[model samples]
Target: MPTLLETYIENRFRVQPNHANNNETLHGGTLMKWLDEVGAMSAMRFAGETCVTARVNELDFKRPIGIGDTAVVESYVYDAGRTSVHVALRAWREEPRTGEREETTASSFTFVAVDSEGKPTPVPELEVGGAEGERLRDRALSRDR
Candidate 1:
């Protein structure tokens, strides 16, 4: 079994002109792509198998990230079933120099592990035991409410 913390993944992307809209903020599609990529990585880490996104819950964009800012994406597996891994994802607008960050986007995703034949494959049980693991799981769960 893999612990919940073992499935955590974080990645940062520097918003450039190509990733921004006419208003000079990160484009929604670009952010969504980054979120999906990070979420899939976390699911794969937990499942130990190729995972495909099954569903994406509501994505709420709280603020815009400027072109020169950095988008920090974090993801972790909070819960899992026989074949499905549930991941919580969050993105923050960060100032590289000041190291300041503010939440910009939040969402959850469901991914299913797959075999070579593209059929569903079973995933190992997630160990959310320890205080750190439990705290992480609780925080993710609470965000849904």
Candidate 2:
């Protein structure tokens, strides 16, 4: 079994001109893509199989990340079904020099584990036993409200 913490994944992307809109802020599509990638990685880590995105819950952008800022994306598996893994994802904008960071986005995703034949496959039960695991799971669940 995989613990919730064991499925956590964090990645950083430097926002450049190509990733920005005319306003020079990170594009929504770009951010969504990053979120999906990170979410899938977390799901795969928990399932130990290839995971394909099944659904993306509501995503809202709270702030804009300007070009030259670092966009940090984090994701972890919070719950799982027989073949579906639920992941919570969040993104923050950070000033590289100052190390100041503020959350910019949040969303949840569902991924289905797949076999080599691309059919849905069962996954092991998630272990959310320890204090840290429970805390993380609670945090993600709270975001639902």
Candidate 3:
């Protein structure tokens, strides 16, 4: 059985000219696209098959990442259904030199495992047996203070 922690993913994107808006900050659409890509990867790891995004439960853009900064996207599985996985994903804006960061986006996405024919398929039960897994799941389910 795979644990939620094992499905975690973290990736960073440079806020370059191609990824930024005229204001020199990361564009909202660009951030959303990156979020979906990373979220799907996390869900697929848990499902062990190709996964298709079914829904984005929540997405809040709390801040902005300036040009030359790094956008760190993190994701992990928090729960699972018969054919779907629930994932928590967030983006943080970091100063590449100083390593400072602040939350820029937060989201919950649902992905369904699919067969070659693109039909939903059963996925293995999600396990949260370890302390890390429990902690992560709890944090995802709780409201930030």
Candidate 4:
């Protein structure tokens, strides 16, 4: 059994000129790619197997990460089924120098653990407890519902 905290993942992506759009903000498509990458990694940590993206729920880009800003991405598994894991993901734009942060996007993702033959495989049940685990579980579940 793996705790939710054990599956948590966070990554920072520096917004560069190439990653930005004509408006000088991070491109939405690029951000989605990053989100999927992090989400899959989180699911794999919890599943202990290769995981593939099944679904990415509604994506809402609330704010733009300007060029030179850092995009902080967070992902964690909140619930799991026999072969599927539900992950909660969000991204925030932060000033690299001052560390000021503001949420930019949020969404729920579902991942399915797969075998070498590309077929779905069973995943371990999430064992959640402790203050941190409980808090994340509650937050993810509420957003998921």
> After superposing candidate 2, which stretches have Cα over 4 Å from the reference?
none
Model 2, 2-31: lDDT tens per residue? 899999899999999999999999999999
- Candidate 2 achieves a global lDDT of 0.95
List model 1 lDDT by residue over 44-111, tens digit each: 98999999999987799999999999999999999999999999999999999998999999999899
Tens-digit lDDT track of model 3 for 1-145: 7899889999999989888888889999999899899999998888889999899888898988998999999999998899999899999999999999998888898899999999999999888878998998998888332
Residue 108, model 4: Cα distance from true site in angstroms: 1.1
CA lDDT of each prediction against the hidden true structure: 0.94, 0.95, 0.90, 0.94
Candidates' RMSD to native: 0.9, 0.9, 1.7, 0.8
True lDDT of residue 41, candidate 2:
95
lDDT of 2 at 125: 99
The CA lDDT at 118 in model 1 is 100
Note the residue pairs that clash in candidate 4: none
Query: Which wins on lDDT, candidate 2 or candidate 4?
Result: 2
Query: What does the lDDT come to for candidate 1?
Result: 0.94
TM-score of each: 0.97, 0.97, 0.95, 0.97
Q: What's the residue-level lDDT of 30 in candidate 3?
A: 96
